[model samples]
Every structure is written in structure tokens, then in C-alpha cells.
Target chain A: MKATGAYEPIFAGERRKRLDDVFTCYPTKRAALLPALWIVQQTHGWISDEAMTEVGQVLGVTAAYVKGVVTFYTMYHQHPVGRHFIQVCTTTPCNLCGAEGVVEAILEHTGCGDLGATSADGRFTVIEVECLGACGFPTAVMVDDDFIEGVTVDGVPELLGRYP
Target chain B: MGYPHEPHPKETLILSKHFGDAGARSYDGWVKCGGYQALKRALAMDPADVIEIVKESGLRGRGGAGFPTGLKWSFMPKERRKPHYLCCNADESEPGTFKDREIMRWTPHALIEGCAIAQHAIQAEVCYIYIRGEFTEPIAIMQAALDEAYREGVLGGNAMGTNRRIDMYIHRGAGAYICGEETALMNSIEGRRGNPRIRPPFPAQQGVFGMPTTINNVETLVSVLPVLNEGAEWYKDLSLGNPKSTGTKLFSVCGHVRKPGNYEVTMGFPLGELVNDLCGGMRDGRTLKACIPGGSSVPILNREETEACLLDYEGCVEQGTMLGSGGVIVFDDSADMVYQIMRLARFYAHESCAQCTQCREGTAWTVRILERILRGEGEMKDLDLLLDLSEQMTGKTICVLSDSCAAPIVSGIKKFRDEFEAYITGAKQPVAALT
Candidate 1:
């Protein structure tokens, strides 16, 4: 987990205006925490301590409070990840339908080698996630913003090929 | 967007009637298909009358618990002395349930219209649809639909020129399963960690922003459309037999099934037919070993119990399970019951909020014990120890996440003791170390 240096302000100019617009939607400015965190992640690959402080300052909360909220959620990465983040659903429903084999294939092909590890080439970071809520489509893999369903061992290479 | 299979003859299809139709996602398409008629008519009637019609229809909550939907609405302050809020639980993170995802994807307008009507019924000016963050597709679709609705004057300060303020917004969750609980959802919206709050000050009393709030599941809110459109009697008559459990329910079939999708059938429908006929029955020749009739949170049923189970609130209780989200996970003869049980335990262990000692420790300890047993290092006493731990886990937490972990472990050991015994006795080979 390498830290990308030179932390810059996230809530600036257009982004600050966007956050301002969302403030009217909620009765409290603090309620925009989740959406603000989402905006930070959408801009930067991961959230750092410095970003947390900036977000806290904007939302009128503390950096420690922002950190507490970020760590509680699995989606908010604290450090930089590979260019493409892969979350494979290995919950019971997916596991019952050959999700393990698919995980094996993804690791082997993506070269992530193990769960929660980034590939040596810095292209992929694969992790096993619990229930993507698409149990009907077993082994649902969310690569970055894409929700790829019905993936199989044979389709691993073709699936990742699109990302590269 | 079309589902692979056609609607089975047994499916009644009211809420799912417009599924797979791309046009139904738009505001215009929804209006053309008689969608907003309920909201229009509901605006003309007294809000109490709207709640009464829903109460008369007997439509219960679909997001587990099966509580009466209209009764839940009536809990809100009727005089509107303070600001009232409505929460739409679109965080469909329950393991086996995904019908709400389809609703937002194919029929976004239905959810918005339902929320608008619910806002009127509960006398709330603002509504928030709390959708899980993982649902990027549904969120975008729903956001687009909402923009269309606002542009068309269907929802705003003066909704449809009715002079009633109905402001609906979507609040995205940040990957916490416990937030699906009503109180936790409120806290999450307040920019705090998704920890479930203690009850008895309930949501209707103090909710998001510490005001009177009425929260309902995405499916439960959408079901109100049929009750208002076709009248309460028509929806009440759709049930198979039980008057207590009325109207159609969407069952999400997954696991070792041939044709897996959301099957909308009336209440009191036989589970056997849902599995055998509608789901195309265990592949070609594979016989059913077990089934989790509800979501993974509910107890598992053995083959005989599954075959005899009925798909209703009362019928499911008789067979020793609750109709929780109606996410049926089928297991074929080839499934390893011991390993599958371990996976469910791991899911809860990872999702525990750590606020409650029972859930935080109980879920992790249960996973460890199950892993040890799977690793071929268990005694016969381990089974009893697990049961003891499960008892401690149940009813001892702020939320049911730990109890959810205990359900499958307890039920799995009771129904499939032979499988557990086989692993202990070394009759079954130890599985390879999983990462």
C-alpha cells in the first residue's frame, strides 16, 4: 500500500459548489457525509488522512470522526488501490455456485495472487466481498464502476481484458 | 433488460408486471401505463383514508418481519405538528434478495410514485430513498427517473399542482449491512457510522434528523400501487388462501437452480411448486438436498421440510422459518452442507458493527468454530458448544446480524447432523485451506 504524496484539497471550486447544492437536500450539512465521501473517492483513487481532515472541516465534523466513518465502510479505501478495483461476491449464495473457482481464475489471471492485494503491475486489486445483493447472478464481480454478472472461470481473461 | 424466462403460469405479476420493459423506466412511460393514477387519486382523498385502504388490503412489509404496512404508516403523527419524514429502504443488501434492484432498474418511476404516495399518506414533505452504494446501476437509473419526475412537475413544492410539498431524495449507503436496520439507516443519513440505535424511541417517534419518520422497504412501498388502483378487495383476493398474508410477493431464486430470477406469485403459494415447476427443479437430475426459503438470515429447511413448506408469513412460521425477503436459495445433492454453513457465518462476522458484545464476539467465534470443524479438528462436544454459543448470540444484540449468523448454524446442525458428524469422524476429507 504505497501512499500517493502531495495531498491537495478535494472540495474546491466546482466540487465545492456541488457540495453546496446537496446541502439544500438534507436538513443538516452533516447528512451529506456519505455523498461527500463518494465524491472524494470518485475524484481520487482512495481517501487519505489529509482528505479526511479537509472533509471534516467542510462538514463541520472532526478528522477523527471522518476517519471513524470511513473505516466502518468497506468501500472507502484509505490508501491508493490498483487502477481497477475488483470485488468478487463470495457469500454463501455465490460460493454455492462455483464462486471459488472464479476467484481462483481471477487471481491467477490478474496476478493479484491473494485477496486484498494489488497486482504487481498495479492494474488490479481483487478482494472477496459479501453478497453484492445479486445472489440470483452468482459470483457477481464489481470492477471499478461496472457490475459484471454471470462471470465464469473461462471468462476471467476476457473480462479483465476490457479493463486493460 | 428482459429476463431470460417468461412468466410462469403460476406467477400473478402485479409489481413485476412492467419488469423487463425499458420504456416503463421513464416518467412518461409510467404515466401512460397508469402508474401515477394512484398518487393523483390519493392526493384527492384524505391521507387517513389512503392508509385505511392499504390496511384493509392486508399488505405487510416485504423487507422481513412482515408487519402490516398501513399500520406502520399510521404510526406517524397525524396532526403534522412537527416535520415528518419518509425513508424508502432500497438498501437491498439481504443475501438472497434482489427484487428491489430490479424494481429500480426496470421501473424507477414505480418506486418514485410509490414514495410520493407514501409521502402524502404519512403527511411527510420529504422522503429519502436509502439505496446501498454497491448498486451503481440502480442509483443512476433512479436518479435519472427522479430528475424526469421533477422536470414534469410530478414531484416538487407544488406536486402535480396539488399545493402539497413532496420532496424525495436518494441517500446512498457506504457498504454497511447493519445500516439496513431502520435506526442504523437514520444514523448513517446523519453522517455517522452505521451503528444500530436502541429502540423504544422508535423511528416514528425520533428518526433521521431527530424527527418523526416512517420507513418502508422499496417493495412494500411499491405494493401500495396495486391496493390503491385495483381497490383493496382485488389485492386481498390475490392470495392463495391465507387472508393474513395478502397480495403477490417476489421470490428471488438462486444457488443450484436451472432458471433463477425473481418469480412473483401470490401469497400462500406452495414452495414445492416454486422450486420444482417455476425454478425448473434442481438442474436435470440433481435432487434437492436443502433450501433457505427466506434470505440467508432465516433458518434452513431440509428436503422434506422444503417440499412441504408454503410461501406465506403464517405458512412459513408453521414450517419453522419466517418469510424473510423471500429469497429462496436452492441446494442440490452435490452441495457440502458443512462448508456452506461456514460461509454464511463468515458473512455475519464481517458485517457486525461491534456495538453489541454478543453480535461482535458471537459472529467471529462462530466463524472460528465452523472453520476449525471444517479443518478436521473438532470433537463431538464442539457441536454442543456451537449450539450454546448460538443461544447466546440470539436475542442478545441490538440488531439481528449475530442472530442471523446463528440461524443457519443452529438449523444446519439440527437438520444435517450427519454431515457435521461425518466431518468430525474423519469420514469426510478436510477441505483445502481457503484464502
Candidate 2:
């Protein structure tokens, strides 16, 4: 749940440059929060208020303005996620395809059920969410931005193996 | 396909047989089906008459808001300065809704032709299709279709050899549900945070780079092509009942069903028939416990309400909810209401757009309380607290995101109190009790 050394590089020169690139497009600085948060999330793996504050300062916006954009969308991570963040789609379509079984397998494997909860070994964190928008490929889970579809209970280990 | 034998309901501007061909996509394919002829015909008529035709069609917004499309178009001041814009809100992120995606993938030309007609109607020179970033493939497909239209003189300068020159572009959102909202979508298209703007001058008055603009959903505009071709009366009779809400709705049925996909059914079909017949009912002989008539935003309907309810705008309103986005999510007997609520609470908590203090703090509170109840650490007071917080969150924001998140929880707890109470009392009950 805490920021680690692996994520420290995100606050460095290149990430800030990417954040700067996103900021220049908006007429006002505050409008850059969502895209800045996305870049920070991509580099740091999650967004902290500190990261949000940094983004606010860089974009010449208030921390409150940055926080508002960060929390609005489900995709942004506010806290430290596991090395691999597994988002299992439990929306109507994926649920019909036995998304519950995928959730069960994930919980059994990770020993954590809460969103943003890292496993004891810091391997993975499982979050159940609404539709990921790939309804045709039902029972889909996004493992660190890559979608694995038609997931079954038996496929948990293999799905996790690709990450760690 | 033996899907169902339900009679086709009345038609409207959007659901006419003009582009109903399942395999319709190419510019030639659409032209063969009499597509951009509406745009050409519309270009020849006075722009006001084009708006009049839409007004005569009684076409309501197919997006969740259901605002009158003609009225929305009319809001754009004709005397406004140059560079009026038309934005197609293709950012379909509602939990159970997938109708737009199918249209984009299978009938891209329908959407393009509709956009052309809409641009001609509004006298807008530029159109932007703000698609969700998650729709990677669909966006590419749409872009390709735009290219094809340009190549064939269907789009871009001198569209179909007319004096009106309208160009279209596709801009993708990184990932934000609120961007599905019109104002937020304009912001996203303008390369800004997708947080919604306060409305006084609605998008019609001031939108997209501070010019007069009109935003319509993909399905809503696509329906226009058929309306202009077949006339308002022909389109109006497509629905089974309800003149206000006429047309075949693409109901995306999901959860606990044997046959779950986009089933286009006319308005006023019984919810029971849609599920039992079109959706082939619940799988494994399980009984239906509850249903979310629309997307995650609508109130959950208990089995009796679900069975008796009709699938239409007025029908759902009569049952104390709106037919929002036509996302029918069915839950079976084994489903856990407490856990389900917790999931919904978490989603709202994650997606609060945290601008206002009430939404930010209240959504987190709702999530915490729901999590406590689901974890069996809840007290009776927690339920009251949850309701109180949800009440405070509603109607206290710049956008309806707050209300959309709160409406279902307040209704869910009120209608399914026994389920919450059972979690508190630790009692064993029948599968039907929670629903």
C-alpha cells in the first residue's frame, strides 16, 4: 500500500516531461489532471495525493483540482497497487460468463479481496469492476493493462505467471 | 435464429429499415441501402427545414438523458459566429450498455451517414466523434470508414458534391466514464480533464471550443437517416405504444441468462418476455432474483417488478425508474445482494469525479458503510447513515454523476431492506428473500 523504490523514477525528469507535454494541450492547467494522472499511473503504477500534488504544482493548479480528476474515473489508482493489478470484469456481460469463478480463483491465489490490497508477497492485487467494454470476450480480466479473456478458475496460475 | 417471436414494435427516426441490413458498413454498401441520400436531400433543403423534419419525427435523445433531439438542435443559435460544431458522443461507458459498440463495429457507415445528416441539419462545418479509448478497434474501424467516405467524396470538402463542406474527426478518451457526459466529452475532446463543466448555457448554447454546438449519441443520429428517408409518420409507427418514445431499442441483456447479447426489441415489450424469451431466461434452471432495468445507474427491480415491468421509457418511469441506456442486468437466486451493493458502492467511490465536497466525501462514506455491511460488521445505524449520505450526495453536483451513483443504492436499500437486515441478523433465508 506504500510507494516503493520501483515507483520513485516516475517523479523524475522524463515522467515530468511527459506530464508537461499533456499540460500544454489544455487551455487551463487544471484540465491536465486526468492525462497527467494517467502518465503518473503509467510510470508509478498508482497515484498518491503526493503525486497529485506534484502534478498540481507542475500544472499550476490546486491539489484539490487535481484530486477531483483523479478520483472521478475508475481507471486511476489512488494507492499503491500490487506489482500486477488484476482488474476482473464483473459487469453484467462478464458476470454471465462466470466472472465470479475468476474472482474466487484470484482471492484464493492472492489471499486478498479488497481493492488495492496487495498479496502478502506483493505479487498481485485483485479488483472487481464493471464492464471493461469487451463484452464479446466475456469473463475478461485485465492483468496490468493486458486483457485476458474467457478466463476460467483453472487459468489463474497461468494468468499470473505471465506477470511474475 | 429462433430468438423470439415478438412482433416488431413501431418505428422512429433512428430504427427504420433504411440501414437494417446486418452486414451494412461500406460507403457503397450504405449508398446501396440509400444512406447519404438523406444528407444530399438535407443539404438541398433549408437548414431550418432539416431541423423541422427532426422535430416532426419526435425524436428523443437515445442517450441516457432522453432530451428531445430536435429541441437540442434548435438550441444552437443560427446567428452564431463561424465554426459551430457537432459532437457525436460515442463514449459508451455505462456498465451494462453495449449497443453503440455494435453499431460502430457492424454499421459504421450508418453512424457516418447520420453524422453527415446531422451536420447538414445544424449547419456545422466540423464533426468530432469522441469515442472511448477502450474502443481501440472500433475507433480504428470508424476512422477507416471516414477515410473511405472521404475517398468516395461522401465526406470532407464538397461532400456528395454539395457546397456544404463538413469534415469529421475521431478523438479517443484515455479512460473516463464522466466523459460520456456532454460537457465532459467536450472538455476531453478539447484535450482537458474529463470533469464536467457547470451548465447554465447548456452545450447547445456554448460547447466545443466555446462555439455553439450540439451533441447526440451514436444511435440517435444514425436513426435520423431512416427518418428523413421514410418520413416522420412511417418512423413514428415503429413502436408498439407511447408516441413520445417510439422505436426499437437495442437492449443489451446481460447476467444470469442463457442467451445474452444485444437484442433489438420494440418499446413496451414485457420485461419477462425479453428475459424469458429473447434472453432464454436464467441458465442452469436458476430463478431470477432481481434485475437492473437500465445500466448500473437505475434502481434494482425485484423479481415481481421485473416480471411485470415493460421495457420502455414510460414503462420504467411508471415503475419508479427510468429506462436508462437499456441495459438489462439479471441476477439469479444465488446472487448476494450485500456483496453486489458493495461492488456498486466501490464503483461510485472510485468514479466520483471528486470535484464537490459532498460527492467526494459522501461516496467514500457509502463505500465504507456498504463494505462494513457486506463484511457483517454493520449495525442498524450504518444503514441510516448510508441512506443519509446518499441523500446528501444527490443533486449536489455540477453533473448527474452523483445522482446516478446514489439513486440505485438508496432504492436498493429501501426495496431490499430484508437482505441488509439478514446480513445484520445472520439469518438463513430462502433465495427469494433478498430479491
Best-matching candidate per TM-score: 1
Docking category of candidate 2:
acceptable
Tens-digit lDDT track for model 2 on B153-218?
A: 888778888855878877667667778889989887764667789987787778888878899999
Question: Distance from true position, residue B398, model 1, in Å?
Answer: 1.0
Compared with the true structure, model 2 gives a TM-score of 0.81
TM-score per candidate: 0.98, 0.81
Interface RMSD of each: 0.7, 3.9
lDDT of 2 at B362: 83
State each model's CA lDDT, in order.
Answer: 0.91, 0.76
Best by DockQ: 1
lDDT of 1 by residue, B1-435 (tens): 114479888788788988888988888899888989988889999999999999999999999889999999999988988899999999898888888999999889999989999999999999999999999999999999999999999999889899878898999998988889889999998889999988979999998899999989999999999999999999999998899999999999999989888999999999999999998898868999999998999999999999899999999989998899999999999999999999998899999999999988888999888888888897899999999999999998888888888999999999999999998899998887742
Report the C-alpha displacement of residue B267, candidate 2, in angstroms.
1.9
The lDDT, on a scale of 0 to 1, for candidate 2 is 0.76
Which consecutive 10 residues in model 2 chain B have the weakest lDDT in total?
A: B1-10
Task: Quote the positional error of residue B365 for candidate 2 in Å.
Answer: 0.9
Query: Which stretches of model 1 miss by more than 4 angstroms?
Result: A1-6
Going through the candidates in the order shown, the clash numbers are 0, 11
